[model samples]
Target chain A: MSTSRLARGRAGTSWPRSELPEFSPRELVDEINAGVEQGLRVVAYFGAAEGSDIRLFLVLADDAQSEIAIGTARVEGKAFPSIAEACPQVQLFEREIVEQWELEAIGHPWSKPVRRGRSLLGAAPSASGSSPHLPAVTDFYRVEGAEVHEVGVGPVHASVIEPGHFRFQCHGETVFHLEIALGYQHRGIERALATGPDRRSLHYAETAAGDTTIGHATAYCEVVEALAGARVPARGAVLRGIMLELERLANHVGDLGALAGDVGFLPTASYCGRIRGDYLNLTAELCGSRFGRGFIRPGGCGFDVEATLREQLVERLERAFVDTRSAVELLWGSSSVMERFEATGVVPKQIAKDLGLKGPAARASGLTRDARHDHPSGIYRFHQIPVSSADTGDVFARAYVRWLEIQRSVAFLRDQLATLPDGAVRSTVGPLPEDALAVTLVEGWRGEICHVALTDPQGHFARYKIVDPSFHNWSAVAWTLRGGQISDFPLCNKSFNLSYCGHDL
Target chain B: MLDLFLARLHQKHRTLAFPGGPPPVLPERYRGLPVINEGRCEEGCTACAEACPTEAVLLSPRLGIDLGRCLFCSDCVEACPTDALSFGGDFRQAARNRDDLVVDEERAIRLATALDKKSRRLFGRSLKLRQVSAGGCNGCESDVNVLSTLVWDIGRFGINIVASPRHADGLIITGPVTENMRLALEKTYAAVAPPKIVIAVGACAISGGPFVGHPEAHDGAGSVVPVDLYVPGCPPHPLTILDGLLRLLGRIEEEPGKRAR
Candidate 1:
């Protein structure tokens, strides 16, 4: 069932241009379908335009073998027989490719606009008629029954969030189906990256997902550095690891608080929320920006932890953890919080595996998968964090998994800070090698952030693709809501806290 | 119940004493405005402008920087060999008119032009704003969210972010206003009760920040609606956002006594 022609590689390394086996559009579908049937998950399937033609790249993540298989295909026409019909995981990726390249995935049911904007195959795109850039304006999946009713919320939600639409087909309080309409936050980031790696490109990466700023930025930097064949100093790698873990700590703490707030658990909500800021402030102390925007630059970090700063960070971390432990412990102690969380929004393990769910969401569903553990690079390669998972795929499990991860990340940071390798923070970056493809996977706080960069014959970036953890987990959010009450939607959403722009980009 | 009460008591008030109390401690790395010393620039040097990813810096034009369009990534400052540019602690980066956002050392962004007498009467006491994120990256959205947290507690000043435009006296917007969300932003602006204020927060909303001139983006909030106030930064610090709101309300205390570097 496995394709013998695909080339296998680890994350953060570049493959030669000719190494990946190219197949006809038909062979591509056959290989992906066969691979899925044989239990291999299609981690990322994306398209990059090659002059007048479109080229497809597939990343088949084989968890059992602990290896990632890379393959390629050349499209012959405006449409191809849908592979998504056999493998449900490629459904959104196919939709994205169709919208991006103006190519149709024929016979793929639920074909709709994903990240809708200008078409790449030039004007007069086929899918959305003359103007192909309308978001949340497409045909929605409808349910027909006497009691079936639809509730449409967002693109502009009640809370301060990035814009995205959520349509739920509900039978009274119980939600039968939840269809998410995104692309409202799409700013053409991928299109902008085609001619990047300039000074501006890094800044774009830094804020690609905002909250996952370090995640996306590090992935982008790793790709550039890999292509450039530059190795960051030991101290630099250590600092990157610390910042990454700190970012994870900040977001996890914030999410825990937000989850509590969703259930009206005020003590943990208030305390954790405040502690979240304290963690962010700690990051701010590392770099100037609280969100770590300029912190994770290429080659190394923008800011280094000196002796005094190191002491300050350790002290602040201790204080924040003290508050975090007590605040999060409240969630476990409260019966009301536990009752609201335990069984609400349960996503079975089979659903997670079939859908290719990732990050903490996948871990919560009893899948012991983490990029830091499976595909280690930099500091993670030297010092590994144990994978945390739970058997019950529910709101409680998701929250519980996050708490477990937060503790590990905090401990990881304390250890890293205590024994920071002494060396120069910044290293000189070399030029990129000609005709290379770099695929990097960073275990961002959300889950896995995969960035692929294909360089032209001249070593300049020709095509760049980013697969945020949110891209894989957004469908998981829909899966969790299948039998959940409509009122629990907010709780379910907070448990995931997926990024709209991360997926939209 | 006793444990919950004790949990609350142990966590004494965490809010900062900002608009009234002593100014909170800003980190050494916390960037605000660019302090441009034009005289310090090397001869015939466009290095800063060349290094600026967003073209926020212009040398021939009196070394001006349009903070509205600035990512504030500090690449320009870092690239300056002569120490001509350094980030200053002036967190007051709100402007009234679009042109007021462009600053040299001379044109520093201070307080936004106070609202007209009528707006001061209507919303000066208690202002309710509806925030719309057209195509924000969520950095600015999250920072703005922090204002509602116990640390900021912006509600203490009678300034609250309302859920609906109908209940709002103004609209606070983030993002570069992507084409996909242009319709939503316009509709939201039209929905707010009249004599409404529009405050454009972050580099994206002011001038598309990192995404300027992209075909997918409409540039900034001004492209669709008339923006009354523009808060600048990639995502302006929460204090800067608070200072903008307070300034618009004419509640800004005459520049705090001593400025800490």
Candidate 2:
């Protein structure tokens, strides 16, 4: 038999559409499953409608080889055999494809609408039915017993958080299963991007997950640059690296603080919260927006750091890091906090691997996988930050991994800012190539953010698929809840700190 | 516990004396209230209007920019051939009326006034708000959350983001108000007791920001519930959101033309 017909490319590079080899639908599913079985990972598996036919595109990352393999398959009818039964990571992608195109994935264990009941190609169902299809109003996995009562949480949450429904099957205080139904925050961003890179495309990317503005923005810009064949200046790349690390610092510190807060450890929680703002203030000082919106553009960075501002940022960053160290160290000292964090919401290594988790969640489970390390792009191609990992897959492991990352990110930022290169911070990017496909992988603070863009003959986007790290990690959140105390949900949730809007988008 | 105490002491009291002595000193790069020099606009120049992603800039009758729709990205300011538009450091940008968000070169924004005396008496001393992020990116949600941190210490003002809508006097909303969240948002507002005020935060919650004209979103919160105050930004700075909240409670007087320290 012949080997899988997959064309290979590096992250943040573009290839002609003709270069992608096409296979029969069954052959393509077999090839993807075969690749996953041999230790390859699925980056993006989505369907795009071309003319009257629905085409399925698969992007698999060979992390060990540091190369991405792309292939396409055309579905003849409304259904295709499920590859998710062999490769679990493509489960969500398959569901999303089903939701968007109304295609069926036969033999898939769980078949349900991934987003709201509103189809991508059709309007929402009218409310005339006895039980109308709506966002997050679906049947959940039930644990049937006299004592197996279910708890249905909100699309309207308790805190100032994004909307999502969380249903838990509980026996006394222990949870048997957790089913998360998201899609409340969806604004049809993907559908809106088909004719984009116009004016609002970059804005959509920046707000893909508001907390991950820099991450998604960088991914989007890299995709544009790849299609346009624009090379970002060295200085621009370094500045982005600084901003990205700064973003990571802010979020990780905030997560630690939130984790502490969830465990009722007030000292670390109070300090880390204030210190997190300090990090965000540094980003605001560089770019006008606290979230770094409008700072990252297609060709390069929107803002440049001058010598004086660089010095000021360095000073503030140092001050914030010092405060952060003091605050985060308090968590380890308080045995009560440690006791709560250890062995709670433990997602074992095998489960994390099976689920293809990314970022610190996977790292905490001893996966040792980071896109920056595995598939380096932009500044990461030159200045490499070491992957921070922990062996124990518990809440403590997650927090410890973040702390480790915080230390490394601070050091990385300090070094990058000190050696700030001198050049133009931005360059003009021209029109994208006609009939091309581009994929860019960015190691966002949360995890790997993958953006795949397929351009039409007019150089406009034909299909744009954004695979947020949350899209992969949300299922892990469910796995963490299995056989754990129901009350530890908040702590487990804060430890992952997945983006709801990112997933919804 | 000894170590915890020592760490807490080392952290020190970091709260700012905002709305008391002076406002926080924002960075020089911080884009606040946009300034439009309509005189600098050349005849038939549509650069600023076309450059805007949300069509926030209106160039027909007069050169006006809508803060509700603006992303504070300065794309229009940069696109202006003659520098007709710029953002000043004055961060007081929130307003009560929807039309007040549209600022021309002539008149400034009509800032949000305090609630009626009876409503103020009901919520001023103690205000509990339920935050509903209709379709918000976490940007607005995070910034609003920043108020409760020690630096902001919103609790000092007797304001809290309560858990239940039943306990809330109002709803603090973010997002472009997507269709999926419309029912929940309406139900949330309905669940709150009568005489409830809804403060829409962020450009998304105010005018749908960049997501404007997208069929999936309802433009903003006003399309559903009547918003009492509009806090504007891509995600308004924590100060911007707090200022809007304070103004509604009659805690802080409007400091017109006052730039940040």
Candidate 3:
């Protein structure tokens, strides 16, 4: 597998000079198959092109090794073979493609139209028929059983979360099958980008999935940098890595607390909430915004740490680490919390792999596919940050993986602080290149965030596609929720915590 | 069982005591309240006025700021590279009347100076705060989340972000004040029960961010109400936000000179 040749090309820094490897739809598919044959797993595939013809980009990865590739193809004349038949992970992306670009995926078992009645692509549906841009009725799945009813749970939930619908097929208290309906929150972010200025487009990209701002922005910048042939300075790279890890730590803390709360572990939840809030306050102290916004820009960061402030930050983090460790230990020792988390919503290893799961979801299943290590960007390449994984893809494993990651992030932050560099914080990024096509990927707290940027003739953004990790993982969530008791749904859902707005966009 | 007790004992109550002592101020560099630098004014340069997307700045014969209309986007500050405009740490800008919010250039400068002095005096101090999303895009909320994580570690400074407004000494509001969230915003303020400060984080909260002037937009947090400190940016940097919060707490001594420089 190490020597296997899929498609070899040198990774370039910028766009106009970057070689554009134009391949026919069939050739692209063949290349994808070649990569898959060589042990590369297809993580996600999304459609992004103007007019009738839809372009598909496949994100391929390997868990045991660090090799990532983005391959492109055009689905011609309406009929595209379903990868879901071979890789169950493609099902959601295929459904999303059908919903967004109105592409038809043939021979997919569960190829249901997930997001119906919402398409802002064009005008209202004509009197003649439903909009061709919208998914057809045939695209929806039909479940049959006596006295088995389907309960639709959203477009909106009671929580502070974004909108998404959960279709549960329940027989008594047991959930036999689950289907998710999303896209209600689709703000046409990608389409909106195509019409906006390329330089200022990163703002919208940062907000594509609000929580994953840094991740999305990092990915967007990476794509731009690659297409533009710009090199992010070493200091900037380190700062970016620090910011990414900070983002990861903050999210993990918040999610962990929320997960504990989902299981009625109020104390743990409250502690975690308080800890999470403190973490955010620290971010504000360090960078200025609670979310680390504006900290990251195109080529580098917008601000740098002062010597005294950096030392203060380091000491503060150390104190926080000690406190969090003790709190976690207490939570673990609690029988009530352990009982609720363990063995609930278990995702088997085979199922996890077949679904092409990534991030904590895949890591819990023993697939230690971390973007920080796998496709190392910034200072991550230099640092030996450990990847947390477990074979048991259960709620406990998810929580444990997050806990472990938080510790690792703490260590990473310490290393960054110890070797704080004194240099310019930001570097100038030149104008974007015209007729540029590039892909950038970053590992968000949830999973890999991929962005594909296409510049127009006037060097403005022609099309920008963001493939959030939630887009791929939501299906896995539904699959995991199946066969579990209905009461455990919230715990299972909380374990994954897929972003509705992230996926919908 | 023993571990739980020990952990609880070892865990210093991270919540800051506010209203009990002088409010914990902010750091010198913290970005918080807005102050106009009268010295940098080009004797009638309307750059800030022109760049004010929301027309928050009224630089007629007398320079005055309608705090009700001022989003605190800091565009006026950024547009003023001469450093005439700055963020004041004194984020207690709440009032009943629109007229109360209106501050002449001299008062604006003075308020800005007072905040600067107070923040510097209370550096590394703690404050109890409440966060409200007054029709925000959730971006600011996410950033706020990052502020508490291990990397930033805002808790070490004794800052506690409470959930309930009544328990808070200050309010961190992020949003463009969507029509639907208007009541919630007001209720949050009312619930805080006064002697409370308000920190507007993000362009949306400060100046409706990008949603300003949109027919779809519902005036903005500032338009519907008043703000104490305003940290500007589409979403201001987490550090800038921290500075605003710190200033409100009176942890750090503030410098009005920075605003004008």
Per-model CA lDDT versus the true structure = 0.86, 0.90, 0.65
For every candidate, the chain B TM-score is 0.95, 0.96, 0.54
Which is the leading candidate under TM-score?
Answer: 2
Best by lDDT: 2
- What CAPRI-style quality would you assign to candidate 2? medium
Q: Model 3 over residues B4-27: C-alpha lDDT tens digits?
A: 677767865655343223434454
Tell me the native contact fraction for each prediction.
0.80, 0.92, 0.12
Q: Calculate DockQ per candidate and list them.
A: 0.67, 0.73, 0.12
- A best-first ranking of the candidates according to their lDDT comes to 2, 1, 3
User: lDDT of model 3 at residue A489?
Assistant: 88
Model 1 chain B worst lDDT window (10 residues) = B252-261
- Evaluate model 3: give its TM-score: 0.77
Error of 3 at A184 (Å): 3.4
Q: Which stretches of candidate 3 lie over 4 Å from their true place?
A: A1-19, A23-27, A50-54, A62-70, A108-147, A196-200, B19-30, B38-79, B92-261
lDDT of 1 by residue, A1-505 (tens): 4436778877778898888889887887887877777767777887888878899888887666667888899888888668676677889999988988888998899888887866665553433222345667778888989989999998888878888889999999999999999988888888888776787789779878999888899999999998888888999999999989989999999999999999999889888878988888898999888889898878988888889999999999998998888789889989999999999999899988888899999999999988899888789989989999998999999999999999999999999999999998878788888778988889999998989999988888888898998998999889888978999999999999999999988
Full-model lDDT, candidate 1 = 0.86
DockQ, structure candidate 3: 0.12
Interface root-mean-square deviation, each candidate:
2.2, 2.0, 7.6
DockQ-derived CAPRI band for the predicted complex in model 3: incorrect
For candidate 3, the per-residue lDDT at B190 reads: 84
Residue lDDT tens for model 2, A354-469: 88899999999999999999999888999889999998999999999999999999989888988988899999999999999999999999999999999999999999999999
